[model samples]
Target: MDEITGVFIQESREQLAEMEAGLLRLEQNPDDQDNINAIFRAAHTIKGGSGVIECHFIEAFTHLVENLLDSLRNGDIAATPLLATLLLECCDQMSSLIDVLAAGTPAPDAGLLARGDALTERLKQFIAAQTKQPEASSAALTVHDSSVEASGGGVVITDSWHISVRFGRNVLRGGMDPLSFIRYLASLGEILGIETVTDAMPAAAEMDPESCYMGFEIRLQTRSSKADIERVFNFVRDECDLRILPPHSNLADYIKHIQELPEDTMRLGEILVRCGALTQAEIDDGLHLQKDLTPEAGLEGEGTDQTPPTPPPPQLGEILVEHKVVHKEIIDAAIVKQAQVSDNKSKEARLVRVQADKLDQLIDLVGELVIAGASANLLAQKSRNGDLVEATSVLSRLVEDIRDSALQLRMVQIGDTFTRFNRLVRDVSKELGKDIELSISGAETELDKTVVEKIGDPLMHLVRNSLDHGIEPAALRLQRGKPATGHVSLNAFHDSGSIVIQISDDGGGLNKDKIHAKAVERGLIQPTQTLTDAEIANLIFEPGFSTVDQVSNLSGRGVGMDVVRRNIQALRGAVDVDSVEGEGATFTIRLPLTLAIIDGFLVGVDKASYVIPLDTVVECIELKNLPTDRNFLNLRGEALPFVRLRELFEVEGEPPPRENIVVVQFAGKRAGIVVDQLMGEFQTVIKPLGAMFRHLRGIGGSTILGSGEVALILDVAALVHAVSQGEEHRLLAPPARHKLSAVQNVRQ
Candidate 1:
């Protein structure tokens, strides 16, 4: 029960987040019925879950919110900004209620209760407003929300059905209210008769308040098909034994369904009539016919021998069908449908939900197995044993495949995170009274879960900064010859073994002169220094740097851009800016696909080994460059930059005569690493640097080799950015020559 409660809370909160995002989108385009339906579904899912878990507070409040959302979905109420705001607030209230449930509190605290009440009253008002809308408006739009799930061809719809429900003991304890399901059923059609069965109930002394001891037999009469009737109990289906017999079912069908239920004192005839499947007269007539068929009926009171039976007694169902009391089609459809449901249940039972932490543990174990496999492979080759070497080689390949598959489990689509920003952008722009619109592309790009979690904050800072500073107001944008509504676009794509996220805005781009002046004024740069536009723009990342003369609520504390840079670098990633002063600015963030494990190329710098991400390694070539002072090589008429690791890290030893250059590309710039030996590919598990080594540059992380030697994984992206920022003398600074300018110079 506790485990299920934890799952319910986690999932419900996620659903609420989805709902909030959907509501924000719906506000923009109220006519988007799909988004409206999605929001409705989210609220409905959370409500159903709350009921199942017995969190009545959340369940009840969400019911009201769900009702309002339903009205919007049905076109009974138009989606307005005010209504969207109220719905978003309701999402927050649901989150708070979920928090209370998660804390294991038996009841809501005073503050929580008051907050819920306030939100509830607002939702009721909105619902009331919905009722005041003209009916003709909604009449034009469709409202077939509760249509049948499926209907077989050439089959008649069941008019009346017998639904038997025996809720589990944990239903109430788990937070589900059985009564709500009955109400839902009544909503679908008229619940003609319902008989509560308390035969399973223990004595009052032994009764537990949390336990559910109630069962019910319901007779439903509606035009809805059998599938629709079954859906009312879908939420409790997992926690209840449910059986439905179609209308006009004979005694055989009733007996079959009855026998399938748990032991109860309810008679077959009583169950049938109570479910409204059979009327009183029809059942009485059937009983009378049965009595007449009995040969000893007349001889019971007389001391005479019974008359011999002429033939075998007819079956109750056969008698009903023969008498044309029940349709053969209804009987056959009910039996066939029941069989299909039983098969579906059998398939559903095979699925199991495993916690994410369990998957993480499994991946960690797989990593160890990979290391062990590598060791075995190394030893086998050393032993000069052909069979053993071959066997371990096979093992090594399998382990590598296993590692890839394991990491894939943690790769989630980045779209979920990207869409969440729509709401943020909307709310923030509204607050600032700016007509800024956000457009997103490449939402299907996938990244590691851990990377996704950590990237959100950095992305948020960049986005908010764009809204607060980069985008000009509607009047200003119009004066600049841009559309009145400024546009901020977010684009993500997988590039060269990394995910590149670009945040661009079409407003007044960076004011380079203002930024440079601010930097010089703050002593972040030398007044005499010469820099290009891109270099000047990079000054915004310096600490205590901002062009704003006055602090604004959204930004201008001079604390954002620097932190954004640091956070991105902390993830072994890099961030750079490109902008046209009057056009716009694009902050391009390049992040690795995964931070935990990667495929790497091992290289030896004299005696020390370094690992370069395999995906970034475009190719390796023999070193023949002799460019004086400049740290670049002319490869195939292209001026590709190169860094000598032995010289950069100051590795001790005489230089190896035969050195190789491994060409790597990051963020569209190509660079090379000078090494003495190429040590082939390796599966690398990244371990973070110690606190003492945290300040080290060019080294992202440390990984253990099969020989147990620690090889530092090169921060290829950072190293390339550093080279782009400066020539041979500087590690990472503003680039000496802008990339585009340098390319043009090289081409000339």
Candidate 2:
């Protein structure tokens, strides 16, 4: 029972998934033949699978759907909007059926079956109506003829045989059209007498058009063999009772045909009588004394005698193919499936379904390797042994390579995530009565899978925000000399070892003055404050900040955009906004390529080691004694703002006699980091400090340094923003007596 239930669940889930995918595609391309075919195939597969597991309810429902889709595929009916809606409902019903199966209970609603029946009848009427039109009728008839012709050449027969078929009581309701099977059988052989049995059917009121209460006793007068007859019912053999008998020339055949079968019959004689080949009285009389002996049950006892008919060993390739139950082409493409199981068996080559936790553990171990390599470097440096130092350097390089490889395993392209938004935009655009087109680019950009997973919701909000607020309605767009269809584009790319995702929409650019006014009204900003467009644009990220006059279903509860910004910031990433009035707005998010270990430049500021993300560091230059403005640095006359970390972190030490500045750039803005010394590149494994220190500024996270000291990794973006803002000048200036300490901390 467990095995049967498992099979049903697995098959039902697969069919449901296929149905969902097909329904989505059908919604997009209602007239697509391939889409229709795919949908029909899913429904057909569900019907067949459900029938085998004796789930008559599902089988019956899906069969009607399959027939309708088949009619659509054959041009017997057009794919009308009503039909599509009905099919979508069918998909929903299938989902409900799966839920019921998962819960190990009867289906929740019988209305689904009724609806399915009504939908089937409506589809049938549509097909009938379509056939009344000459052109559609001709096309459908042509398809039927073609299908018949295609089945003509496959008939293979060796000896005449009789086939008895008793379809299940619910077979009709289960969606199996008895006529189609008869048509298929007739294609296999010449029929002599096909007597339809009606003994099992109940009264008319109890009859179900969707259920099969009929059976057949067939005498096929052809040279076709038993195997040929069996092949006709191959797909439904498990759901029906079938028996085949060889032809004979005797009065015994007539007498055995009249038998009233036992509750459970055995052997060739019983099988023949059950198939109406011979009468019961003849079998009872001919072997009256022998009936008690099991061996006298005719050819059925042959299995116990004559070498016991040794069963053929299954072919390994075939067995594997059956057990995996994948498509034949998939098995053929992988040679492992074809190799002989006995000699080629190797544990290493076999596919194993390992828990994802194991892979994460492996990645964690690789991160440890990086930390260990850093520790070894520290040991070698202190030992002052040239060979040991060289060996440690080599080990460090190897560990760096391993670290990169391990992290790469967690990198996945962002295309699938981006594609999902296409549907979202389509649905939301329709709901808002806006003509919006979503264009995606740079989808092949790769990012850490963990980041990608967490980033989706934020991206979604940004997109919805753009569609709702950023994009103007069709009429407004036309009045503004823009295309009726507004364009929203999602692009992604790698920038300086980080993933940059940009969502831009072509609408009337954000109304800067209106936003400023709204911000002032909400007390978010002072009325007298002067602000740049970028600053005004960023105000949208403030919690409960919205410019919409009235809230609608789409957005503007003032709840979403702020959360989007917060989530992105939590990833140690930055989000920037840009807009050109009437040229659309772009929200760009920059995130580290990986969240684990990274190549960093270790520096000392006031005796504290700080790690700077190496990718953001553009270059290092000596800070010569040339006089300069108090906060500005002359990087060949570039006027870059310099942030002295000694003052920023308030470290106690004297300024180094010679100092260097590490120039870093982000979002096209540059800043200089003043450090006591420049340590060459180090592989730093980022370890997040517990929630206790999450609010710490200047320090993004901590890493273990080579000397086994905790090094704070500098948040370059924050430091750069601080230098740009210059709001902490008085706080940064050190106090006296610490006069040398003040000098060390870059005192005024």
Identify the leading candidate in terms of lDDT.
1
Off by over 4 Å in 2: 1-28, 38-71, 80-140, 143-354, 626-629, 725-748
Candidate 1 lDDT tens digits, 1-748: 8988998988887888888888877777889866887788788888888888788888899999989987887667878888888888788788888888989889889998898899889888888876886666421322222322234543223335678788999998778899999988898767878999999999999999999999999988665655576677767766886666566534444444433332234444454454444555556666788778755544443543554534556666555556554445534544454456566677768855677799888878887787788788888989999999999988988988899998988888999888888888988988989988889999999999888989999999999988988889888888888888888999999988899999999878898888888888888779987776777888888887888888988898889899999999999998999988879899999999987788999999876899999999999998754643557778999977777777677678876677899999988888888898999999998888999977777889998888878889998876786665554224333565433332222222
What is the clash count of model 2? 14
Off by over 4 Å in 1: 31-37, 70-76, 105-111, 128-352, 624-630, 728-748
lDDT of 2 at 592: 88
Supply the TM-score for candidate 2. Answer: 0.64
* TM-score between candidate 1 and the true structure: 0.70
Model 2 gets an lDDT of: 0.71
